[model samples]
Target: MEDDVRDDALDLLAEVLVWRLAGDRWRAVERALDGLAAAGGDTDAFREVLHDLELAGPARAVRIEDVAVLPVPEPVRERINQLVHTLEGPGRAEDDPE
Candidate 1:
């Protein structure tokens, strides 16, 4: 895959991950998935990333340092607070018996 496409795929993957980690950020999820569909092209890079994401199991911890390394866009940052809340708040998987 080309560098630009790879970057876009990675970006979309990160967004999906953040949504998953954050728990049900549906709007962001929809937007990111839409972006992925638009840029995905013939490359399996996004699919591979998504597959890995699925196999990874529930998120353990989403550290600030980890998120800082990503090239996440500005508009997405607008929802970071909610994401962080889901990570740290009562909605976390650890709080559930199942």
Candidate 2:
């Protein structure tokens, strides 16, 4: 049961990270994370998961791109594409948004 809860927490964190990188909006991610944390999940761990997602490159980049095409800001789309390219090794991390 505890392991199931932990997995659910991690899944929520992954979803929130993907949504943020896909340009869903900060408030949306914050609200969702807050809800997950309220459900006994560690907020800090969720944040770490988000950080790891950003660093994972290939897998996470593809996930970002798959969601990034749906009515996002142009700048966000550009950033996602840049991250994908960086993951693909055609661009440098310096080109990424901080």
lDDT of 1 at 66: 41
Question: Which residue pairs show backbone clashes in model 2?
Answer: none
Clash totals in order: 0, 0
Please, what are the lDDT tens digits per residue for candidate 2 over residues 1-98? 14554455445433433443333344344444344334333646644544544342223344534565333335544444543343334345456665
Residue by residue across 1-98, what tens digits does model 1's lDDT show? Answer: 45564454455444544443333334444454444334334567555544544443335666664443333344454433333332244455244331
Which sections of candidate 2 miss by over 4 Å? 20-25, 41-98
Alpha-carbon runs more than 4 Å astray in model 1: 19-25, 40-98
lDDT of 1 at 35: 41
Clashes of 2: 0
Alpha-carbon lDDT, every model? 0.43, 0.42
Task: Point to the candidate with the largest lDDT.
Answer: 1
Superposed by TM-score, candidate 2 places the C-alpha of residue 31 at a distance from the truth, in angstroms, of 1.2
Instruction: Give model 2 RMSD, 1 decimal.
Output: 12.6
